[model samples]
Target: MHSLPDVSLRYGSLQVFHSLEEYKESGVCKIPGAVTLGKFDGVHIGHQKLIRKIMDFAHANSISSIVFAIEIQDRPILSHEERAVYLESLGVDILVECPFSREFMSMRAETFAREVLSETMHASYVCVGTDFGFGCRREGTASMLADLGRQYGFQVEIAAKERLFQEDVSSSRVRKALAKGDMKLANALLGRPYPVMGIVQHGRHLGTGIGVPTVNVHPGANKILPPDGVYASCTRLPDQTIRTGITNLGIRPTVGGKTRKAETTLFDFQADLYGQTIQTDLLDYLRPEHKFSSLDELKSQIGRDRESALAILPDECDRFYGGPAFEFHGQG
Candidate 1:
């Protein structure tokens, strides 16, 4: 078991109500208003601004602030847990994370307003972006939500849409930036570096022979991989310490000719990390993967790569040592 928190009662600065029973159970609970926060991928600067408005509105109205986020939605770029973490960090009093099912997706706009917003979440207010849409092929527009709010005796706050450099800030834009390996723009829009998580898996130990040992990681199939190339990245170990590494995120044409593998050559680190989870953030692209004629040539190229990585990396490289070399041959 993951040993996670309670499914029903989620702790928050804002009292999180799950179902109608939970809402009705807590009677006379400070006007019982809530706002529907969306997928909120990256928790970008624009998202932060809108959330702040929602918090301020709820506070000024003397109502318990509720931020309703969905789980397993059709378009979620981040997990429900990740979204909850970011919201709680920003002082979201209550967070309602409900499974987005077929029933919920097919519900009428009015029913969604009544069941989700009013009955379940006990929302007296709803805040959404100007481009927000919902319910049955996305029939619930901001205008519909506003109308529903009036009908349900609640207020709807429409947050003005935001843009970065004259382009609307959106998850699609962020994905595009990441796809192009434009980390600077992506970070600027995201307000933090984008990252990928994977578990350390054992690989044919080719690095030790070259005097540079590496840990192999296969990123979760669902987790999007950045553009293929050698990247200067930071690895966050299970122990919570960050280490610098050079990552190759492409088909290993040199050694593993048939199967491509994503490998991280950690600098100055030596620990048994197999089966442990690792988070890596790409800082800069170093070079394209090149095939070498022989082991000596490959090692020479890797040495140069290490030097380049060290120079680009902020701190001194760790002179880490690990297990002995194992042979791996490319079956071309």
Candidate 2:
């Protein structure tokens, strides 16, 4: 198996691919030498290795790091904005998000190879995963692509599948791990912690009145949630500051609420965080979500939850909590 490349590309300062128009308008791929690549669903660690190879190959050969992928019609597990941001962070020079529809899906593998890969992308080289398949019933394989590369005058490089702890690593596997609250295994494969980002909204303010302030975040409807439970999480505020908090992900039982919502109460935080975008990374699972009859019951459980959460939080956070410098935002 060919060694997979390293994927430690810094994302803190890269331009993201948001639209096809933005990509074409940039004219970056119009350069004499340009390589094209795929849909890259999760842009997960394995995908990163492939992308890194493409980027490195492009740099060494003076080719544009053009990535061809389906943008719409194919529902993304991650929002386009989020996926684009992550890909950009991985240093993809040009990202072409094609609309993947029944029409595209029904096209012959030959047509996809010639029309999409050769004509539309004008790619000098194509990179793909060994198990990659395309067309109706997913007919195409790496060998077929290699055959096309021979006929179309472009090169094809297939990346070896990535593995972790002797097991193949994939988005599906990571998803399963997350569903089971296996954060360590998931993070080990993801190369970083999984974070849920969303804008904070106004809740009933019930927790605040009880001295347990909380931030309400409406996650992307389709976004996967860790089994409804309380988690020890780190919340990243817009200002890039991170705070430790205990987050409840489930229907509110104490106040007779029926909707399943995520409520995060930042310990020792007294800021109004309404309308702020924040991200939470679940570090540990505390317990399965449950229903309680009374406010007192819920409050008592929360108190215990806070104590447990604090024990799990980094020591530095405990020292900083309630300090004058630890100012929070939102309606105070």
The number of the candidate with the highest lDDT is: 2
- Give candidate 2's total backbone clashes: 4
- Scored by CA lDDT, what does every candidate get? 0.66, 0.68
Write down the RMSD of all candidates, one decimal each: 8.6, 6.9
Residue pairs in candidate 1 whose N, alpha carbon or C atoms collide under 3 angstroms:
13-93, 14-93, 14-94, 33-124, 268-318, 268-319, 268-320, 269-320
User: Model 2, which residues run further than 4 Å from truth?
Assistant: 1-39, 61-63, 71-77, 311-332
lDDT of 1 by residue, 1-332 (tens): 11112212343343555543455566634357657567665677777767787788778987666665555534444444445545665677766555577777798888988776776556777888998888888899998999998887788888887788998888778777877887667767776555555567887778777777887776544544467778877676655456777888877777855545568877777778888656566766788777778878877877777778777665321211111331111111
Where is model 2 poorest over a 10-residue stretch in terms of lDDT? 1-10
Q: Which parts of model 1 are misplaced by more than 4 Å?
A: 1-33, 54-101, 257-261, 315-332
Clash totals for all candidate models: 8, 4
Task: Give the CA lDDT, 0 to 100, for residue 182 in model 1.
Answer: 78
